[model samples]
Structure formats: C-alpha cells, structure tokens
Target chain A: MIRARRYQDARAQARSNPELAWWVFMRVSGVVLIFLVLGHIYMTFLLTSELQASYSVVVNQLAQPVWKIYDWLMLTLAMLHGVNGARYSIDDYVQKVSRRVWTKTLVYGLAALIYVLGTMGLFIISKAMLAG
Target chain B: MYRAREGQWAFALHRISGLLILLYLLIHVVSISLVLFGANAFTVLHDIYGFWLFRVGLIAVTGGVLYHGFNGLRVAIMDFTGWGTAVQRQLWYGVLAISLIGLLITAWVVVPRILAGH
Candidate 1:
C-alpha cells in the first residue's frame, strides 16, 4: 500500500512540474543515444584502421543513403538531448528568470544553427555523391 | 553547495559528463560536415584527429559517454518504472560500477591500439 502511494506521489509531482517532462525526455533520449552513439563510435573508431577512416572512406560511407539517415538521426537526437540538458542546468543555476530566458534563447538559437548546418551538410554531401 | 553526498556527486558528474558529450557532438558535427567541401578538407581534418593528442582525447570522451549513457539508463528506469524508484540508490551504484568496469576494459583494448597508431 505504502509503495503504491509513494509511486502515486512521485507521478503527481512529475505531472505538476512542466520541467519534469523535459527530465523524462532526457532519460528517454539518453537511452536511445547510448545505442546510437556507441554503435557510431564502434563503427567509426574500432572497426577500421586509421588508414580506413580517411576522407575517402567517409565519403564512401556518406555516399550510401542508409549511412546518411543513420548519421542524420544521430545528429538530431544528440542535439535535442544535449540542448535540453543544458537548459535544465541553466534553470537550476540562473536564479533570475529574465537571465534564464535570455540564456535559453541563446542556447536554443545556437542549437538551431548547428542542427540546420548539420542537416545541410548531410544533404549536400548526399547530393554531391549522387552527382559525381 | 560544496558539501555533497554520493548521490549529489553522481548528479554533478552526470551533468558534467552530459555537457561534455554535448560539446563533443557540436565539434563532431562541424568537422564531419567538412566532407561536403570535398576530399582534401575532410582528409586534412581526419589527419588531425589521427594525432596522439586527439587519440588520448578520445579516451576521455569514451569514458564520459559510458558513464552518461549508463547513468541515463538508471535515471530512465527510475522515472518510467515503479520498481526502479525503490532501488534507485542501488541502481546508481550499479551504474557507477558498470561504467568503471566498462571503461577499464575499453581503455585496455583501445589505449594500446591508439598508442601504437594502428
């Protein structure tokens, strides 16, 4: 009975705070990112020699549509996950609301810029490969 | 703020590691984007990453990623499931243990290879 009540209370608390949703997102995304990132590291670093990781190797890999999607997913998830985490820190450390708002605006702007650029890079590379 | 317990330390470390991973992601995205510039730009960047210092940096990144990834799982279990909250502390310790052991194994396998520049 007590355990159930405690669980209910925790759930209630989470529901009450909007920020808790982001917290949940962090956990969920973190789990997914673990698989994505570890796989990426294994494939990029461990699967090949230094020679194999050369520009040509990367170009070849990006030439494949599947690899492009895989990388795009990795970039998108990582940006959202990390940016939300940083926003949490900003909320915690910055006492003033106005300051927090400004900081978050800056953070979000930068994240958007990076995400756009990354997407463009992936698309451009795919097009270049297809053309050549 | 200065005095902290095990859980607090864990939280702090998670935050730091999370931030580091994010920073690295930013750099990784920009660098990989260089592929669009053609072969020479991409290969030049790859050559820089092949240096010993960057290889050493990879160890730190690997460690950070392991801890954050495992700890994030623990946090997720606690948040999304009923049973996990009951043993949250134990789960955290489990995360730390796994991270340490996993990192040790990774370093053992990777460090030598990186050092020898294969």
Candidate 2:
C-alpha cells in the first residue's frame, strides 16, 4: 500500500509499475463507484422500500438489459475495489510471510467466487425461468 | 497501541468500514443469488429479512457504505489535488457530516417501515 498524500509521492514510492498502476486504479475506481453505489443505495434503500425487493421485483429488474448491465458493472467494480483495499489492510497488519500469503489467497479466492456468483445471478434471471 | 488523532481515526474508520461493507457485499450477493433456485428458495428471505435484527442491520450497513464512500472521495481528492492535503482535516469533517446526514435520512425513511413490518 502506497501511503502517499499526493500522486507524485505515490508514483515515486511505488516499487514497480503495477503497484503504481494499482495506486491509480484505486482512485479512479473509487470515484466511479462513489456515484454508482450511492445511486444504487438511493434507488434501492432510500427511494424504494425494502419490501419492494421481493422475488418478482428483483426478477423483473434483472430481466431488463439496462439494470443487468448496471448491476454487473457495480458488482465487478465494487468487488475488485473492495478486495484490493482489503489486501492493503492484510499487508499492513498481518505479519509472517506465510500467513500473509495464505490470507491473500483466501481473500482473493472468496472474492472471485462472489464475483462469479453475482454476475451469474444478474444474467440468469428471466420470467420463463421463474415460471418453469 | 499508538494514540491516534483525526487522520488516524479517519484511516482506521475507513478500513473498518471498508472491510465490513465487503463482508456484507459477499453475503448480499449470495442471498440475492438464491433467486436462481426458484421462488420457493428466494422467498425464504422474506422471513429472515422480516426479523428485526436484520432490518436494523441494514441501517448500519447503509451508514457504513456512506462513510466508506465519502471518505474514499476525500482520499481521492487528497491524492490528486495540491490543496487537498492542506485541508484534509476539514475534508474529513465534511465526510463525517455528510455521512451523518445520509445515515439520518436513511433511518428516517426506513425506520417507520421497519416498525410497520413492511
């Protein structure tokens, strides 16, 4: 984790090109996710009631291509962003190289699984499937 | 343990909130994914969610997301801008204020509904 207050510091402190790239990705993805996620909360939790998230409502929303793409974007972006952030935490607190590696492997594996599950759920829903 | 001031508090809160939100997201994805199993499987959520504990937990999740998102914006601003570092303390306050407002708004809107059992 590059703990720099400015972009120049981050660039200079980066051990490798990919580390610097991830430093940049965190900011970029963080900005985009702020809007996407806040809007999602606003629509789902603020504007609409939780009761509206009933099975039929969720199925109908997923059936639409627009919501499917929007949710997929959120799932992918948020998962990557959150996983990377957690990796930084793991690096900071976890001592012992062996423990760190195992922790990271588990974290990455779980993130991948959740990402695939979320993506599949978003795409696999349709009225016919629900009926059948 | 090191004694922390505003910046440390900000960093600590950001990390805790970020990890908690990620945990919630994993569970959320799995629960929502149950739709693939058919209505019978999905409807199980109605009973679980109707539980008061889960309903209240959603409010906490909302607050956590708000703080993480706003503090994240503060970090981005500090990263890319020259003046952002100078005013980071103020920016941290702004993040907290905004998050509080969001939490209040969410609770206001959702609390009654939860009470009414909707």
Could you report the DockQ of all the candidates, in the order they appear? 0.54, 0.83
| CA error at residue B92 for candidate 2, angstroms | 0.7
When only chain A is evaluated, what TM-score does every model earn?
A: 0.77, 0.95
- Candidate 2, A17-54: lDDT as tens digits: 98999999988988898899889988988898877788
Worst 10 residues of 1 chain B by lDDT: B73-82
Residue A38 C-alpha lDDT in model 1:
89
Index of the highest-DockQ prediction: 2
Model 1 native-contact share: 0.61
Query: B19-56 in candidate 1: lDDT tens per residue?
Result: 88888888888888888777778778888887878877
TM-score (C-alpha) between model 2 and the true structure: 0.96
Model 1 per-residue lDDT at A78:
93
Report the lDDT tens digits of candidate 1 across residue range A14-129.
64565555555666677888999989877776665544676666777777789889989989889988998888688789889899899989889888887988898877665455
List TM-score per model, in order: 0.85, 0.96
**What shift in Å separates residue B109 of candidate 2 from its native position after superposition?**
0.5
